[model samples]
Target: MVIEYSGIVVRSVLTDKREKFYDSKGIGCYMFRIDEAEVVDATMHGSAARFINHSCEPNCYSRVIHVEGHKRIVIFALRRILRGEELTYDYKFPIEEPAAKLPCNCGARRCRRFLN
Candidate 1:
């Protein structure tokens, strides 16, 4: 494990409201969804893991693991990453309508062109 994506866990229904609140204040939202009803709000208390960008072909991957009785998000190396290599992972966003798709510039040979 490289680092934990630390943050407060919140109900998924609150994501939209919180994101909008952040947007109104020009605060960038940084969150990792855990499931249909849970998400980690990292905009205010995240680690460097939250700053890692997306890649079509990534060297790291994010996972949710249970420890004791708590859930945590962890970033793990996907392979033998060379020194100084940037850490990244596929966002794996849910598919959306074309008009709402986010453009991807990951530049991988097999790039999907869109993130969703």
Candidate 2:
């Protein structure tokens, strides 16, 4: 028997290409840190996964999968998402200073005003 799943689809990557635009604007954020000098920036070649917005109270979350010395970001649903609902997840980036906070428009009831 063949089974089919229909909700949100995720993709994977295995490269490190810097985004000068984000770096220049200082608005870009790292998806995951692989090492002291390297980070996984989904915007480099992201798919639908990149488009997923951030929510303080996200319905989805990401998990890192290490395989053959490479790190991949996998997103999983935290609950049964209904059709037409926007897929969102927390960026989970650390915030050390007020100057580092970015603006957020997620529209979540618990929106923190800034994306940390």
Candidate 3:
């Protein structure tokens, strides 16, 4: 499906793992792994797929929904987002291992002291 606003059109995928690859512009892509309240054959392992990245204070948040009988992650805006703003969410919530933490370079004024 396509999520459009202004002239920007983002392609959303309904594949397993909610995989997001870098676009031609180097921006992370967005997709919906579930459709019509049904979860795709996606099982989100604690890999890069779970690392949506973080912000000092993010403008979006991730919500897990149990559709049909599977779990899927959905990102929603926390406030009114401007047209050119980069969408980000807290990745720490999904990672359970200490090794999952990495250095963040988001450059937010209140960025976490460390990338964990």
Q: Each prediction's TM-score against the native?
A: 0.95, 0.66, 0.48
Off by over 4 Å in 2: 1-17, 21-32, 35-37
What CA root-mean-square deviation does each model show from the true structure?
A: 0.9, 7.2, 9.6
Count clashing pairs, candidate 3: 0
Give the best candidate by lDDT: 1
TM-score of 1: 0.95
The window of 10 residues in a row where model 1 has the poorest summed lDDT is 44-53
* Model 3: per-residue Cα lDDT over 33-116, one tens digit each: 333444322222222333345686788776666569745556678888889777777655333367666667778888875555
Candidate 1 vs candidate 3: which has greater lDDT?
1
Candidate 2 lDDT for residue 54: 88
Worst 10 residues of 3 by lDDT: 1-10
In model 2, state the lDDT of residue 58.
90
**lDDT (Cα, tens digit) per residue for candidate 1, span 6-108:** 8889999999999999999999999999888899999998788889999999999989999998888899999998889989999899998879999999998
The lDDT for every candidate, in the order shown, is 0.92, 0.62, 0.49
Clashing pairs for model 2 are none
Top of the candidates by TM-score: 1
